[model samples]
Target: MLIRLLYASRAAEAVTHELIESILSESRSRNPALGITGILCYGADIYMQVLEGSREAVNKLYNEITCDARHRDVTVLHYEEICERRFAGWTMGQVNLAKINPSLLLKYSERPVLDPYAVSGLASVALLEELIATASIVCRP
Candidate 1:
């Protein structure tokens, strides 16, 4: 069965644009081969990612991510069998929160920030869906 796993993690340190680009490049190159499609949102030194794929692939990837040195305090926000992929078109969609509209952020949180750790998994997913609807530009690789 297919599954969608959402997780949040803090960057080990300040992440540079170059680093983010490299991460996206690697994901773009690798995810398709594993049947993975997802959206990765980065802001305020935190990452909120939604990965959709076969259960095994998603679980394996989540394990690898938790062990990666770049991430710390990794926390799974959501995981469940899904009938369809929310990010099917993109191998690895990306959003830099700094570029998103504050109004969009305000819809999800009181402080207009990307703090997935403080939000429910359903809310996190809804926030991502809103981002896709309002700012498709940010979802491109």
Candidate 2:
């Protein structure tokens, strides 16, 4: 069965552009072989990610992420079997939330910031859908 997992975590330290690129580089290289697809959003020292794949793969990946040194206070926002992949084409799409419009952020967040911890899982998914539709961020192979 296919499953989708959403989680939010605080960066253990300041996250830089190079660090983000490195993470994406590794994800793009590893995810395809594992049959995983997802979107990663980062800003304000917070990260909100959605992973979709087989139950085994998604669970394994989430477990590994929980142990990663780069993340702290990792909280699973949502996890469920899904009939379709929301991020099917991207092994790991990325969005720098700082670049998105403040008004858009206000739709899902009260602070007009990227605080996934304060947003519901469904709202997080909706925010991602909006981002994708706007072509705000794209992952290229």
Candidate 3:
């Protein structure tokens, strides 16, 4: 089954444009073979990534992502079986949350790497969706 997982975490430090590109490049190269596609949003000191793919593929990627030292306070906001690919066109789309909305963090989450919704709390799928929609509109215009 196709899996969709939305999660957020805190970046160790502010991310540079080069760093963002490098991360996205690595992510696309690593997951293209597994048929995964997703968007990554970074705001303030946080990183929010929504990944979708086969069960095994998604699980494998999540395992590696959780272990990566670049981020902390990893929280899975949403996870479920999906009938279709949400990001079927992109191998690994990346968005600088700052560029889309410098206040994206305020629209979705908190800081300190240990926010109140880190676990068993409100999930902000709306915020993620808004980011996606706004980014698309801006890019298309």
Worst 10 residues of 2 by lDDT: 132-141
Best by TM-score: 2
- Residue-level lDDT tens digits of model 2 in 1-141: 999999999999889998899889999999999999999999889999999999999999999999999999999988889999989989999999988999999998888998888879888888988998899877878
The digit string of per-residue lDDT tens for model 1 on 1-141 reads 999999999999888998888788989999999999998899989999989999999999999999999999999999999999988988998888998888888888777899998888988889988878876434444
TM-score of each prediction? 0.95, 0.97, 0.78
lDDT of 3 by residue, 115-140 (tens): 32553324456665665666541211
Give the whole-model CA lDDT for all candidates, comma-separated: 0.89, 0.92, 0.69
Candidate no. 2 TM-score? 0.97
Model 1 root mean square deviation, Cα atoms: 1.3
Ranking by lDDT: 2, 1, 3
Q: Cα RMSD to native, each candidate?
A: 1.3, 0.8, 4.0
Residue pairs of candidate 2 with colliding backbone atoms: none
Candidate 3: worst 10 consecutive residues by lDDT? 112-121
